[model samples]
Target: MSKGKDSPAKDGKRKSKFSDAADSPKKSKKASTSANAAASSSTSKAGSGQATLSVKGSGSSFKQLSKSGAAFASFADYNPAPSTKFSIYRADGLPDETGASTNDTDERLLLAGETDTMAYVGNNFEFGSSSEARGYTGHYMVGVYDPSSSSVTLRAVPTFQVARSIKANSSLSSISSKRTFADYGEMTAARRALGDAFGNRKQKANARNQDRMKVDTANMEVILDDFTGGIQDNLASLPSLDEVLASSTSSRPMPPANLDAKHPAEAYRISDLIPSEIFKSLPIQKLIDNVSDPEALKELLPYSKDFPAWIWSRLVDNLQRSSHLSGGSGGKKHTTFDEDEDEAASVTNAEDVMMMPALGATEDKEDAKTKVRIAYYMSLLWYIQSRPKSVSQRGKLITALKLDGEDANKRIVKAILGTFTETPANSDRAVMSAFHQTKVLAYMCALALHLDNFSVDHDKLARNCNIPPATLRELFRTLGCTASVVGGEKRMVLKTPFTLPQPRKGKAGGRK
Candidate 1:
């Protein structure tokens, strides 16, 4: 009996659970229908022309409308009236207090169901010519008026002010086209006076010629003064040529006893090899001659370290000055050096002199000139690479070179390569020796930094440097540098650490 009761109870529980699950979906469907109905009702109300009247933009309820144009009004519920009219009245102090009106004499008829109409209400509404008496300025009352019922329905009562005249006379008061007989007569008289002033052509021409002659005379005087002033002064101050040569050729001036004591070998060696007159004539001699200040002479130690240093510094300086005076001709105009046989022979001899023997020992003038040309180019390249302050001069040089044509850059690259490769025998050894003596390896590295973006191509750099690709790789490796293959190209990059000086800030009370 207990088991039979338990079975009926289980059946009842199953039926109850099934009924609850079915009822949940029905309830959700009814709720969704009610929500949709509410949304539809709100949409219908919005579509029924129940929009609040306001300006298109926010911030202010009262709009500043132009007196000569129509203003729009949004309606809450649009209803057409055949006799609807828009009236504008001057309301000065209070809303209830009505003063003068534009519509008192004439009303602007508005079309039924129209949102906008011409609000200007005077027959003589000439914009700029309308006066304050015509109710064009100050606070205004604007509303929809029905003529049949004699009732006004207030809309937006925007303040009206006279619009700035877009016509010519309003903005440009000084200009006017109105002309009288007197004005025309005055213009004609002025023209005639000008014509009379310039009537005599021969006299005008003579006067112009006289002025030009006077200008030329003045210019000539200026030129004469510029040309003669410095020459005359210098001539008067100059010593006799014989006396000058004697002084220059005199025995080499001795450094102070203290300097000789400190550097006996250097002093004796320098004195024996260099004549006093010749040594004194050096450009750097002036700096060295200040024996009273031995401290300043320390700057010459770097150049005096080795014989080559001393010779090369002076040689490079002379070469640079000559190049500057010649405008960097670089032996480009010498026809003798242009022949392929002569060039090949010269290159071969240069290689022997550079690689096998010491530099400055060659007695051949042609070889010397060629070396000088190469040295000049190297000096210039070094200057441009190492000196940040020379950027302007570099730009000028580049522009001048580019005047040669589109291949000017290529020509320059060839010239740079020749410096490295012109020595046919042991090109790498010769290039290394020249660069070491001149301390131009840093300049070359700086140049590589400048010519390429970040990575310099091995073949292109070798061509520009005028060395074998393998030689260049070895050179970079010797300098403790490395190369990597990127995008199927072998590239080398040298990075050196440097610090830029920070700009000094102005004092608080200082002038800018």
Candidate 2:
């Protein structure tokens, strides 16, 4: 009735305007077309025969498809159906609607335009046992249920097998093996006893006992007060100071024959500054012999500075003369052959000379003698180096070698290095030998200068020098170097003079 009241044309125009205001025809058409295209694309993908289903992570042998996405299967192959259910099953052949599902649930529903993931727990089965026993082996099948078709389609089929967890042989061996637990208790008891015997508590107890014993031993019966009291009592009972002085004078030994009976100072000479005991202990002949003997020379080298100037001079002179004698006199050679003849003769003579046993033997003997002399010279050099510069005789020898001056140590080092390159002769051989023997000594001196004052392990130093420990000990004694056992090892204590200032005595008789 209302439509009739208004004009049909006007009503139609109003409806058209309202519709236009609500939405444009062109926009509506485009939106509808786009949505339809998406639905069609999804349907096309689902219907494509190229879609396949696959399973992954089966075993090491199936590693080719184990990686993620490598064995991924799309649900596109399954035709769209209402209330479609997906199920997984294990089957030997092609799975069908009759096939039993491996999954616990009957089916999984996947909604339209939506995705759902289903996780299924695998059935527990023996892995290695015989089929008759418990294990099973076969392929896994994924089935797709179609309610419209009332049938199941085998979407994916992956092979699988069951294996026994425990081996038959291992099980049987375990059953047959025997073990004893009776010793366990005894072992535990013994361990406890041992722990009690040597544990921290016992160690602490022993330490405490040792401390108590030390304290008991250290506790002296005579204190300072008691000692002073005893001394006073003894003084009261003893003779006076005058009587003691008279007794000491009467008991003294007679003066020496060389000393004046009335005045001993008049007979005293500067030479007497060195005690006669030193000469007595080390005789002149013995000193000369030691210098010549290699073994004895090693012993005397450390005490070289202690020997008198005359003794040092005699030693050097003897070594020089001996070296000269050992090495025959030096003279110019007069060759009978000219250059060409000499060359030819030398070539022919080399083989003949080698063939002559007597000549070879004589050469070897001379070489040995040369080595002995070289060793002797080395010992002499080592001795001279050990001597103090204040010793005029040692200084004279040093000057003669042209090795004197402020940098004496450096000059000596250079001379030592040169000896190795220079031809072996009287003086040169002596110098080289000395360098070889005293190389370690020189190194020690340099180290001492670096450290200023240091202590060295006696054994370690001997080993470093390639000298015997006994020889090193003798050397230490000869050099007036004191060796004392420190930290359970013998050490050479080198004290640098004037390193520390002497303490002054205060007016009150206290050290300042």
Candidate 3:
């Protein structure tokens, strides 16, 4: 052995300097081409996910064009995009040149994907049942031709089976005597007489001899001419890939179908944009009830913009308290005591009550921060409508409510109420219907929560959440609340068996 012989490591794992030098140019060229392709795709705005096809000296082929031109001509490309359009025409099979097809017997056929623009010309011939006396069955040949190419493509393989027997459902005499097609006028000049065969007769023959393709499948030959012809046909008939894709997607929001002019998503978005504080202190449910009429709601909802999320929240709080004070559901009523009971609230109220409240300021500054709590509650509502994930995004929620602009909340509510009352026709009516009950429920929940009345029916509480009545009742039962019929009707009322506040760490804790 020579000392200069290659070592084991060099042979298996290492590239020699000579080899590396030889490969450098190839690697460099590959990298350059890839980078250029990427750059071209980006600058030309080509459809995403489309494969780039290129050819050298291909001349006028899409591949030879610049990226922009390629993209523009994508429809004419032979390859099918995900977004292609096609129309299906029903026919039993190819008709005779005389333009007649018979459907007396059920026929088997294959369904396959095809280019939208290509057309195949097929001819028909007739086959006889026997070497001697049977009528002629039709024969059809489907062939493809391309104007751009000189070659012809013969399509349709004959390996398939033919029905062993075709029952003569029509009168044998009628079939023999018929001069014109049953359905079309061109089927005249009888090729063969079926005559009066009482039953089906088995005739052994191949698919082509029987004038039909056999069971299961058919293969078509696609020649160069056919392929080119197909490409040209597709270019003229099919929409561009971009158009196809755009047509497939919907532009409108998919909220509850019956959303009002202020869509639920839009309303929820607006609520999200507001601060949570506005909803905290106000008796929102009572506010809703007091402004139950559309006109009043319209008047008050826009003013809501002047205050922050906390103020709106406060309104909800106030509304809830008012509902409790007024006695929800119009049952037995009791007079206000204002005695040793409510001592804490009374003392707090006495200290905090003021002749007038300023923006973002309450007589009791700490209580005024109730706005933060208001913002918190509205955020939850927003989540239920806009973000169904059941997680909170405090910043996003607050911002959404604020972005609704001044009085947007009130404006939306007013519009909702108006829609409910008017119940416009068509899509408008649908939108109004969705808001009608939901808005009412929102106010009801605001009232119940603010009053801290766990005794209030949980089912009813959920009803205030603006869900379908049945759904609200189920939720109430799930939460261990009892359902009651109200007003001697099918309408249901939700009530808790009793009120108890589950003690929690927070100071805001109250009756469940």
**Candidate 2: tens digits of C-alpha lDDT, residues 17-50:** 2222112212344554553354334433332122
Report per-prediction Cα RMSD to one decimal.
Answer: 29.1, 30.7, 31.9
> Model-by-model lDDT, in order?
0.35, 0.35, 0.32
- lDDT pick, better of 1 and 2: 1
TM-score of each: 0.15, 0.20, 0.21
* Residue-by-residue lDDT tens digits, candidate 1, 354-418: 11111222223333333343333333444333332323332344443222223543455344333
- Arranged by lDDT with the best first, the candidates are 1, 2, 3
Which candidate should be chosen as best, given TM-score against the real structure?
Answer: 3
Clashing residue pairs in candidate 2 (N, C-alpha, C atoms within 3 angstroms): 127-162, 127-163, 127-164, 128-163, 128-164, 378-433, 378-434
> Mind giving the per-residue lDDT tens digits that candidate 3 earns over 54-94?
21111111122222221111123234434543222223465
lDDT of 1 at 236: 94
Mark the regions of model 2 whose C-alpha exceeds 4 Å error after superposition: 1-118, 121-365, 388-397, 400-413, 417-438, 441-512
Clashes of each: 1, 7, 64
Question: Under the 3 Å rule for N, CA and C atoms, how many clashes does model 3 have?
Answer: 64
